[model samples]
Target: MNICVFCSAADLDARYTTPAREFAELIGKGGHALVWGGSDTGLMKVMADGVETAGGRLVGVSVDFLAHKVRPGVDDMVITKDLAERKAELLARADAIVVMVGGTGTLDEATEILELKKHGLHTKPVVLLNTAGFYDGLKEQFQRMEDEGFLPLPLTELVFFAEDGAGALAYLEEQAGIQG
Candidate 1:
């Protein structure tokens, strides 16, 4: 199954070190591939670089606005005029969503996947590699969704939690069946 590896563009932040490389290596060695925003730098690029080194298949999707800013040299470029188009393409091709710790950009990527699942546009499993509870606030929001009855308990199970890259890809393969 195709995996959309989502994360922040924060190259300067010290936090990008762990999740970036870990997620990339996970996707690469897990016998799966990567579909993510293309950038040559930052967490986004870090993951992509690992994917490349591991020789996994890669498909990078980025909006034109971000095209110049994206991680460079993506194997397959899925460029769009805007974010909406980029996201639509990503959703169309992805079978799973792996969210690494990121900033607002990463948050939006994960939330969009959640929304897609909510509306039944897709049922892809979304794995959030928390990496030191960076997503604690987002987890609370998901809880709020359950509390308000917007999401049922079992349905809430669609979102998987992991603390490191190894755990993330293992759960992804087990739950998503992405050996190919």
Candidate 2:
């Protein structure tokens, strides 16, 4: 199954990034083909590159705005128009969503995917790659949605957490039930 990995392009900064390489390698080794927004550097590229090196297929959905900005030597690229178009294209192609810790764009995209799940536009499972407790606040906000009577109990099951790459890949297999 195609797994959509949403992460920031800003993670190239050492101060802002975490050891998500473990996650990348785990997913790659698990044989889950990657479907992600195209960015040659940063955490996104880190994951894709690791996957490709590990003999995994990493499919990049490149938007017009980010195409020129993409890192050189990406294995596969499909260019689109803009951010919204890019996300749409990615979603169209993915069967699941794995959200890694990231900045505002990542958060916005995660929320948008959640919204799609809420509306039943897609029933694709979503997981959070929670490195070093980065997503505590966001999880709290999801809890608030339940407290405010907007969200439901099953949603807690919808977005599971994996502390590292291994856990993320394992949970992906558990959630998607696709070994290959």
Could you tell me every candidate's TM-score relative to the true structure? 0.88, 0.89
Candidate 2, residues 1-180, lDDT tens digits: the string is: 688999988756543353666666666777768888878778887877777777677888988867786656655678998779888988998988989878998998898988888777888888887777889888888878878888744666557776776777777677676664
Q: Cα lDDT of model 2 overall?
A: 0.78
Can you tell me which runs of candidate 2 are displaced by over 4 Å? 12-18, 72-75
How far residue 146's Cα lies from its native spot in candidate 2, in Å, is 0.9
| Residue pairs with backbone overlap in model 1 | 38-71, 39-70, 39-71, 40-71, 40-72
Q: Deviation in angstroms for 32 in model 2?
A: 1.8
Q: What TM-score would you give candidate 1 relative to the actual structure? A: 0.88
Full-model lDDT, candidate 1: 0.76
Relative to the true structure, how large is the alpha-carbon lDDT of every model?
Answer: 0.76, 0.78
Model 1 stretches astray by more than 4 angstroms: 12-15, 152-155, 178-180
Q: Cα miss at 94, model 1 (Å)?
A: 1.2
Which lDDT value does model 1 have at 77? 82
